[model samples]
Each structure stands twice: as C-alpha cells, then as structure tokens.
Target: MDNLPDEILLTIFDYLPPRILWSIISKVCRRWKNVVSHRVITMWDYNKVLKTHKGVVAIFGIRHQTSRQSPRGLAINFHTLNIRELVLCDNFPLGEMFMKSVHSIKTLRHLDVFTLQNLHTGYLPPPEVNSIVLNNNIQPGYLLNLARRKELKALHMYGRSQYYAVNEMSTMIVIQAKHLTHLTLRCPEISDPRWLVFSQCINLLQLQLYACWSVTANGVAHVLQLPKLQVLHITGSRMVRITALMELIPTLSRSIVELNLSASSFSSQHIALLAATLPDLRKMEVWRCDLTAADVLQLASGLTKLEDLDTDVELNSVDLMYLSEHPALKELRCLYEGEIINDELQAQSHIHVRSALTAPFPLRACGEGPSAGVLLHAHAYKPIDGVTLTI
Candidate 1:
C-alpha cells in the first residue's frame, strides 16, 4: 500500500463515487485525506446529496458528515463545492445562505428557483448565470438585483394566470437581461399586456412560448416589431385570431427566419399572406391548420428560402409533385390521421425515406426549429423517411 506512488493512489481513488470517497475513504488515512481535499470537489449540489444520501446511507449503517454549516441554514458544506448550476426552492433562509456562499463560485452558469417569497433587497448579483429560470412566486420588484449580472443571456420562466404579477416579472426579466438572446415561457393563462414585455429586449434573437393561450394578436404583433428577432415559436396557443396574424404578416416578412404555429389553425388565404410577406422564412410549421393543396403549392412556389415545412393539413399527389421539384425545399413533414399517403403519392418515384418525428408530438412546437430525432405521433400516421426527394 505505502509502496505505491502518489499518482497510482490518486488514479485508483478517482473510480470511487464522490460520496463514498468523501465520507468513508477520506477518514481512513492522512495520505488519502490530502489527495481528496484538493482533487475530489468540482461540481456537486449539497441539497441533492442530502436528499439522496440521507436515507440510503442510514440504511447501510454508514455515517455521512458535512464540512461546515451553510449560512442558508442547511448544515452542509456550503463553501467547498464548485457548484456551477443551482436550483433553490421556497426556503428563504436557504436562499440567504446561498447568497453568501455563491460569491466564491465565479464559474456559476445556470440558476433556477422554483419559488421565492420576499426575496431580499440587499442582494447583488453574485456571479453571472447565462441561463436562468424563475417562477411566478417572486415578490414584486425583487428582480432588480438580476440586472447587475451583465453577462446573463438566456432565460426561461413559468407564470400562472395572475395578470399583474406575471406582467411585472416578465417586464423586469426583459429589462434586467440586457444581453439576453434566448427566452422561453410556460404561462398558459398569461394576460395580453404581458406579451409586450419583450419589446425592451433589443438583442433578443429567439423567443419561445408554451401553453400561451391568452396571448392575442396584439402581443404577437408587438413581438414582430423587434428589430433583431429571427426565431419565433408559439405553441399550444389557440387564442391568436387568424385575422390578427393576417394583418401583421407584412411586419414579420423579413426579420423572422424560423416560425412555428403548432396547435393553431388558419385558411389558404392566410398561407398566401405568409408566402408573400415572409420572403426570408427558412423553416415554417403550421400543425393542425385548415390548408388545402393549392395553399401548399403556393407556399412551395412563393417562399424561395424555405428549407423545412411541417403541417397537419393533408397533402395529396399534386402537393408532393410540386414539392419534389422545389429548388430550396429540403424537408417536408405531413401530419395526417387515417392511412399512410407516401406509397400512393410516390409509386413511380425512386426516392423512399422513412424517419420518425418523435412520439406524442410536442406539447408545443419543439423549440427553435425542426430536429431530426423526434418520433412520429400516433395520429401522424407513417411518414416517408427522406425530407426531400429528386425527380
């Protein structure tokens, strides 16, 4: 044992789980302690350790101990971990302890809090976390401290039906996140005025909305007004009126590159409107819409920049024929109910491709753009494997 070199000993110790090494092995000998105190700690969460290990260790009659008392009131090692991502619950004292310990972790990159009540005011942004998710339970005006973290870039939020509270948090998150580029929301019943919150996020490039049923055309129009936004997704939203989108088509023509309107429906005229207005649109998804064969042809011909298209409206032979010859169409997804249509449409064709679009579909449109790794839904029937075909 003592004859082995320090390198060999350290190499052997690396295979053991962190908990076993820290709690069981470290106390065995001074040489083991020296190697572990410096090498074994990098990325770990104390709360997770306590929750998972507290019961399991006791069953095995093993004693697990913490290094120091957390100022957040948890009797765990608060300062030892090199925690880069953190998620806090509704406990205020724990939040306080974290505020104290986070100062030393300069590499913190992601932070999510499920609920926060009466968050302190003396709080200053500790280290910049590029991705952040906040819940609706935050108190009013409590997010001003987040503005101090200049490096914040991506934010995901969940809000409830409360109009005023959601609006306040949305406004604050946008205003504080000056460099924010990507934003995702999961508020089904959020009010209309809250949709206008992104108007302040000038540098924002991508916006994703999930379960956003209450947002009207006015809100989408406001979002379109952003000068730099390139990707827009509105999923699980049925409240946006077709007429409202028709009126605003001219505004989104050039700025948006990717668009998804899953769980929303519109007519063939509206499809023409999108074709004429969205000259630069690269990928478009209109799942569960009332589009006809002519509407599909119009889009394939008019939108010269389209690379991928997904629709719930059934397409026949004429639609497939036009799409096969399209100069730029790279991928086409047809969502249908009863029988498969690929064999009937391409009986004489040489190209045959079979691929999956993911199971259960998306609760909303999948974020940003089409991914090749999703499974096709039960109602989607079977799809041809290839996204594009020649001849």
Candidate 2:
C-alpha cells in the first residue's frame, strides 16, 4: 500500500462515501490526512468505501477532531460532508454563524436554510451553499448574499421570515445564476413587488409562489414573459388580484406543461381561454375552483396535450360519462361525493396528494421537493428488472 503512487491513492479515495471518508480514512495516518484534506477531494460527497483492513484501520487514526465553535458558531467538520442536495430542518443554535460558515462550502450545490432567531448582533457570514431553503427569520438580505453563489439551481424561501437586511442586496444575482431551474417563494408581504429580480434568469423552468400578497398582476405578468417556465403553483390566504395575470397571460404564451393552483378564482371563462391558448399543457391541478366537469370537457377537447386534471370537484356517474368524451385527458383526481361515474380517466391516472401517499397508495411517506425520492408505494410496484411499475 505504501508503494502505490499518490495520484492513484487519491483517485481511489474519491470513490469512498462521505461517512467512510472521515470515519474510515482518519485512521490511515497523516499521509492520508494530507491527501483527504485537500479541498478538491472533500468538496463533493461520496460513498461506497473500500473494504481493506488498512482502510478500516485508517478511520481511527485521526489525532484531533475539529473544534465546535467560531464566529457564527461555525463548525467545519472537514471530516463531515457536503451532500449535493440539502433540506435543512430542526432548529440550530447560533443560526447566523452557522449560515455564515455554510456559505463557504463551495461544493454545496443544493441547500434548504430555515429557522432564524435573534443573534448576538454584528454577525458576518461566508459564501457557501448553492441551492437554498429559507424558512426561518433570517433576513432577506442574508439570503441575498447566500444567493450570490453561482451554482444554485433551486430555492424555496418561505414567508414570516426575519427582515434583517439594512441594505437590500441585489436580487438580480438570482437571475444571473445561469443554472437555476426551480424556485418557490411564499412571501406574505402585501407591498413588496420583488419579481423585478427575474430579469436575468432566462433559463428558469418551474416556479411556485404562495402567499405572495405583494405581487401585483403586473409583476406576475412579467413572470409569464420568462420564456422557459413550464409549471406554475400559486396559493395564498390573502386576496390577490388576478386581473394583471389575466391580461398578461394571453401574451405570455408558451407550451406550458403543468399548472397547480390552490384556491384560485379563475372561472370557466378563464379556463376556456387557457385551454384555447396553452396548446402544450399536459397537466393541471386545482384545489378548489368554480369550473364544472362540463366546462372541463369543453376545454379538454381543444387542449390536444392535456393529460391530467387534479380537481376537488365531485364526479357523478353522468359527469364521469361526460368526462369520458375527452380523449386528451388520461387522469382525473376527482373528489366527488355523489354517485360514481368512474371511467377510463380514473383507470389511467395516478392521482395522489402529497399527503395521501400514506393513505391508499402504500407508497412510503417522505420529504418534499428535491429530497422527495420514491418510496415503495405498493408491493406490486416493486422493482422488476430495474424499474418499478406504478400501480
């Protein structure tokens, strides 16, 4: 083992998992320490460790572990890892300092930051994570700085957060992140039209906004102009005006693939217009709406690509029969109380709420968004050759 070339040894170390890298390699002596400490090797997380006696022996070799505190209560467990995607939960002490140091992890491609409380004051932070999750009281300004990292791809910042920014950072940086793909912001402020930050993110694909009370129709209209947005999810408790979106949506035309609305008032007229214009829409979900199954049928006939409808509306046997008239729709999440008019639509669709996975699907309940990986929903759908079939 000692005779092996340094490059070869380093290359081999690259394959080991993050837990193994620190727990296993620390026992290999100072040589492996020097090799492993090289930031490049430790930047991204890895797994699948070697099974050698030497490899097993190396983990216990470290002399001292990292100290527990620094400004921002920063702890660099170099022995720890920077997993590619992150979803932070639970409360952390010294949240400011933690966030500050978290910014320096160049390999952090995805992140979810939350929980902000009063700090000791005057806390300076570092640039680290890429994708972000802002859920706590952390001021918008700190988030702006955190957003500076160029590699960020997805961001979900919730409302009711701390407004700690004395100076507004450039929201423009968000648009500049050339790789950003998905974003969800649920801000409840009734007067902050922050969508002006969307000018540069021309590559954005999926967007979801909830409780954006400050968003005027004009701002949303501009978002429709973003060119690449495929899915839109809007939900809020406040009274938001849709007049601007209504006017702007016609011009901001695209082959939108998906749309999710929770408690939206867009009427039958609105749905009719959307069906006529959005020729590429494959899926649309509504939590509560004024449109009926008959209106849906009319809209579906024109929507050549419409494949799924997730509605809270009930379906009667007659309604189900009417629903069968549209060939474009393959699925419907119908929530009806009357007689069952179940048809082919119910047979082809995979309709399960983010929460319902626990009830009927038999799928494992898990986290949301990026961390929402698949769990066994039904035993019958277990992996066959290599793929799992949906039941």
Candidate 3:
C-alpha cells in the first residue's frame, strides 16, 4: 500500500500490535518507515509480555506460530526503529543487548533499569539519555560509570541492599551530575559522609530521601544551602538530628515552599520551629506524628501563605473553628484514625462549613466570565458528611 494516503496507512498500522508494528511492519518500505516513525508509540513491559505464548511470538516477531526458535535466533533491527523510552524489568542481559544494538541512541531520552544483575563490561548507556531510574544492588564502580553519562538531568538510585555503601563514587557522581535537578535516594546504607555528596548538586530543585538513616543534622544543614531547592520531602529517616533541623530552620532559603514530614515523632516545639522557619510555606503535610492542638494553632497563626494543610493531629472544636476562619486556608484535611471528633464538634463544623460554602462571590459582567462555569475550591471535613464549603 505505498499508493495509500498517509492517514489511511496510519489507521491500518494502528490496528496492528505495537510489537509487530515496531519490529516487522515498520521496516516493510520507505513510506511505512516514515509513517511509523511518527505514528508508533513504544512502551515495552518485558516481564508481563514474555510470560505468555503470543507475547513471546510478538516480541521476537516470529513468522510462524509453530517455529521452535528462541528469541535470540531472530536478529531484530533496533537500528532503524524510533524508540522514545526503554524500561528494563530486571533483565540485565536483554538490557545490554538493547543498549549495544540500538543505533538510534540520540533519540532515547528516558531509560529505566531496575535490578541490575551486575556491571558487565562493554554495556554502557548512550550519551543522550536524560532521565534514569536504577533500583539495583550495583557496585560503587558501576554506579560511577553510569554517572559518566553526562546528559543525565534526573537520577534516582535505590542501593540499600548493595554490598558496598556509597562512598567517594557517589560524591564524584553527584559532582558529575551538574544538570541533575531531581534526585531520589532510598539507600539506608548511605552514611553521613555519603549524604554530603548531595550538596554538590547545586542545580537540584527537588530532593526526596526515603529510609536513609545515616543522614545527620550537618548533612541536612549543608543541603539547605542549595538556593534553588523548592520541594523537600523526607520520611522514615531516624538518624536526622531534629536539633540540627530546628537550628537550621532560619537558614533555609525563601525558595523552600513545600515540606512533607512523615513517620517521625514531632512535638509542639518542632511545629513552632517550622512556623518560625517557613512563614511563606504554600503547602505542608504532617502524618503519623505526635502533635497537639497548640501545634496546629501555631501553624495556622504563623503561616499566612498556606493554601493546603493536612495533618493527623488531634484537634478540638475551638482549634477547628479558628482554622476554618483563617484567611489563607483554602483546603484543610484532618485525618484522625486514633480518635473520632465528637458530635458537638462535628455539628459546629457542619454549621460553620455550610456558611463558608454559601459565601457569595463578586459577580462578573455578562460574557466576561468563563464559558462553562466558575470552578470553586470546596472546603471539606471528614466524619461530618453533607458539609461542603466553597469560596
């Protein structure tokens, strides 16, 4: 069908499975190749497909169902295909083949390699890869080599189970990742010395650490010096010195706007410290922590720019009323699994919430307002149904 129009050819190609389209159909003719380059979308999940009969045949592009040949028997033309993203599902050998055989290296931008078997020689990534997510127990030397991929802008590595804790290699990697803006580490084996490696990511805007216990107060204080940091989320970290966190609050730059803390025991004093430190915080969330009504009130009183607040703290009716009346709180969600709010408190919130819901807005001139309808942010409280407040 070289004679067919591009639209019709695209519609026909769309009916074929992605595996056949990419491997078999795209290479049929020059016209098909050009159309497939723009029309075909590639997102392969290796494990789920290779387990079934059709999947095996589709992935290998077997000509006949009765063929007894393995996938390796077929020489797939990865060189001519246009692949946008590649996800390796713990298949290190397959990953190695793809990296080496794929001639369209500069076209590949997002690469996700989870659970690396080992760092085999001659299996390096392409230079154009920008985002990488690694969840394998790779050696420090291997990690250092992967860091050498100079174009990486986002790097997420989970190395908690590795035999060797990250040391100088991690620091060098961070130093090399000059364009890295987002960094996530789930390695519990990372010690304070390794945590210091993060300070070198000067262009970093978002930082997320999970279960990294070796991060000390000094490490966090040093990270706070990053001027462009806007979002910081830390959870399940035990070794982070709260004393250091409290002391370094004032030192944090104004770019810090969103903060999320969970699975940590925090007192009223800690809440007060946060209020003093983050007066311009736009969103804050505290979960599974020890906090009282005074702590919540301190947050309500101090943070005037807060639009979203969520906490599992126990709050009384008066505290709820004061928060509902706060000018900046556009949405407040309180989750109390340990104890339920009493009926008297619920009734009060319902009445106040109803009033808030029906509060009038200045009417816009005819034909000047939005064509569909005005979107409103509704204030809601749980365990008290039928209470919807809007502004």
Tell me, by TM-score, which candidate is best: 3
The full ranking of all candidates by lDDT, starting with the best, is 1, 3, 2
**Per-residue lDDT of 44-125 in model 1, one digit per residue for the tens?**
3334434332112111101122323354544243345454444443332445555666555565555544333434454444
Better of 1 and 2 by TM-score: 2
Give per-residue CA lDDT, model 3, range 1-391, as digits (tens): 7578998987886566444566567778887877765644332332222233211111222111222323232114444444444444443344445556543545655555443365443455677766655545555466656665565676655433334346645755566657778776654577666667778888877776655456666666667767798876665445555666567667776788877665444456676677777788987766555666687778777888887776655565566777766777766655333334456655545322222112222113111111001111011111111111100
Where model 1 places Cα greater than 4 Å from the true spot, the runs are 1-103, 112-125, 135-151, 158-164, 236-239, 316-322, 336-391
lDDT of 3 at 90: 43
The TM-score obtained by model 3 is 0.61
Estimate TM-scores for all models. Answer: 0.58, 0.58, 0.61
Tens digits of per-residue lDDT, candidate 2, 235-337, equal 4422434564456447653846887654555656676577666878898765545667676666666676778776555555566566565667667666565
Pairs that collide in candidate 3 are 357-390
1 or 2, which is superior by lDDT? 1
Evaluate all candidate structures by whole-model CA lDDT and list the values in order: 0.56, 0.47, 0.53
